[model samples]
Target: MAISNKVYAMPPVVDANSRLLFLGSMPGTASLAASRYYGHARNHFWPILYRLHGAGVPDASYEDRLRFALAHGCALWDTIASCERKGSLDADIREAVPTDIPGLLRAYPGIEVIVCNGGKSYETLDRHHGMHPEVLRRAVLKVPSSSPIPTRQHKGLEEKAAAWLAALSPFVKPRGDAQGG
Candidate 1:
């Protein structure tokens, strides 16, 4: 059977009030199949998020997880709008069309911080989204990938989560009244 290569069919999980934006390169095979970001069971995205913000469970429902991130002033999207790949690996990607990041920033002016989940997204943004003046103005944090696929550097979960937490610190809204009587 011939392999289906086109990827990136899901809409971004973003809202008008989002102050922080998390960008992945593109949805992986698991994410596309499940129609959810970071759907691969072994991916550390959820666990890192859960560790950073104690309010949500890593195993929470998809909608609930989206709600949790949105409620906390964050948004999620991919750098590549579409790409052709034989598998889930970023190295296999080809003909990647980047998303309208500048448009998104314009639509949501409140977005003050942008964080890239991995190197590909960061590189994509630099190559494709860097032309816009507004995009160039904002700093993009290129954190370690949370995917289960090991990197040559091999940063531990705690290290990656720490870096993510540091990058997200400025935008994270204070958890209010959690200890209420």
Candidate 2:
């Protein structure tokens, strides 16, 4: 498919050496506009990831947020890099163009795990491109989304955002392996 002017940007790169990868469905309106991940203010992706990885709370800047994710050996990306949606709702998407996820695997030879942010991303990824068997074998976590739209019960966090991050612990270790949650 031709790259549409409406096409949103995917992560600049999927770190090959990552042991953990957080996959969301698609970028929201805010994210597309900002050309970054988790740009929505109400979204809890940043805070949750920071708290979960013991990276301390993130600063009020996009640069810091990206640094935090990259530092933890965790890759951040979305299942559908480009999707036609009137709004941020996943259900509203029409013409979806998923990114070259397989290419990322080939490019980053060290990835070993995938953490789906929600059922939508899970279904998309699980149904479309097949992830590395080795990565899926060790960790294929299905966690909640920070998206307020998916209102449901998650682990202990109550809020989907916090719960999602907390759930990622098994796949993503803390900054130091000396402590385990």
Per-residue alpha-carbon lDDT of model 1 for 22-103, expressed as tens digits?
8999888989999998899888888887666655556568888888788766889999999899879889999999899999
Which candidate has the highest TM-score of all?
A: 1
Of candidate 1, the 10-residue stretch with the lowest lDDT total is 172-181
Residue 147 of model 1, lDDT score = 85
| Whole-model lDDT, model 1 | 0.81
Query: What is candidate 1's CA lDDT for residue 34?
Result: 92
**Residue 113 miss distance in model 2 (angstroms):** 1.3
Give stretches of model 1 more than 4 Å off: 1-4, 173-181
* Prediction 2 global C-alpha lDDT: 0.71
Q: TM-scores, in order shown? A: 0.88, 0.81
